[model samples]
Target: MSRIQGPEPERRLARLFRSLAPAERETLLAFAEFLAQRGATTPEPHGGLREPIPVPRPTTESVVAAIKRLSKAYEMLDRGPMLNETSALMSAHVLQGRPANEVIDDLEALFARHYRDYRAKHLSEG
Candidate 1:
């Protein structure tokens, strides 16, 4: 507790959080939890990333469902770098009238690519 800088940042965060809509607040909290988990976890004893937990995609899925599936399937990968692309694809589906199947296909490809990159980087580092 004493290591915490102060309440200034927490106060600021509270103010910003209060300004967001319910959905946006949920998003903010999820991102914060993701960050906290990312910092908390360490690699396995083998000095490599944990194997991805496979969650098979269902037929005729929604974009939101795809995002959740991919996030689970590729849990070993750092999602920070994928956020921009992920959000863009999500927006394309939600706001730009993109097809759900197409968006989900792109999302699967994006997660696969990120996993490949994570493998190379972690393997080389190991």
Candidate 2:
């Protein structure tokens, strides 16, 4: 007797995931959790996943620099819809004197959430 196969997409995804680095693997898992929580009334911050990378706290880093760094880190996310929220957070940090570390953490969460939303919307369309 032989083992049975799952759906083609699932098989393909598994293969793709197997080829990723440990950090990338964690990022993918986090994104999957985000997708799973899409229907919830209120989603938790950071999709409740372990931190994949340490968010850096450079002394000279501005909020804009943090946004750019996070954008590069989460390249899969769509940036257009996130502009408003990102701008607000940047304002809170710059004008309101919010701590850089806290603002950067929130920025990471924001990017993750937006990526989840983007995936949920587009994945269903295909």
Candidate 3:
């Protein structure tokens, strides 16, 4: 027997994903949520995925350099709203009066939450 294929195939799925506006993004996310629920019984191989591990005592220069790179990327994407004002906002909080590990923890959490929310909002939209 031959496998049946849908007329609207996923040949250019990547391009399709990028072309979606915010509302379309949400609807796609909704579909992903439906699929995830269907497979909920299966466990992930690793202990549930978690935040990135923080290195002990990151150097100020290294953190600043990272901020610079992130800022550049954020600008190029024209995504200033969530960009977190590199120096005065997000990175500053990380670099100021905090243990290196704590800073790393906070930054990692920030990124993870933002990404998760973005994905879920789109994948779960009806």
TM-scores, all candidates, are: 0.66, 0.48, 0.33
Worst 10 residues of 3 by lDDT: 71-80
Candidate 1 residue lDDT tens string, 1-126: 365578998999999999988755765665565445444435567775777788888877767667777777777777778777877886686668888899889989998998888888888997
Q: How good is model 3 by TM-score?
A: 0.33
lDDT by residue for model 3 over 1-126, one digit each (tens)?
885477555556657878988645654554444333333333324523323333333355333333333333222222333344322333344435544445445544554455466456545752
Model 2 CA lDDT for position 126: 53
Model 2 lDDT tens row, 1-126? 885577987889999999988745754564454443334323335444222234565777655566656755565554556666776776677568888778778987897787677667656755
Which residue runs of candidate 1 sit more than 4 Å off their true CA positions?
A: 1-43
Order the candidates by lDDT, highest first — what do you get? 1, 2, 3
Clash pairs, candidate 1, are none
Off by over 4 Å in 3: 1-61, 65-79, 85-95
Off by over 4 Å in 2: 1-62
What would you estimate as the lDDT of candidate 1?
0.75
* Per-candidate total of colliding backbone pairs: 0, 0, 7
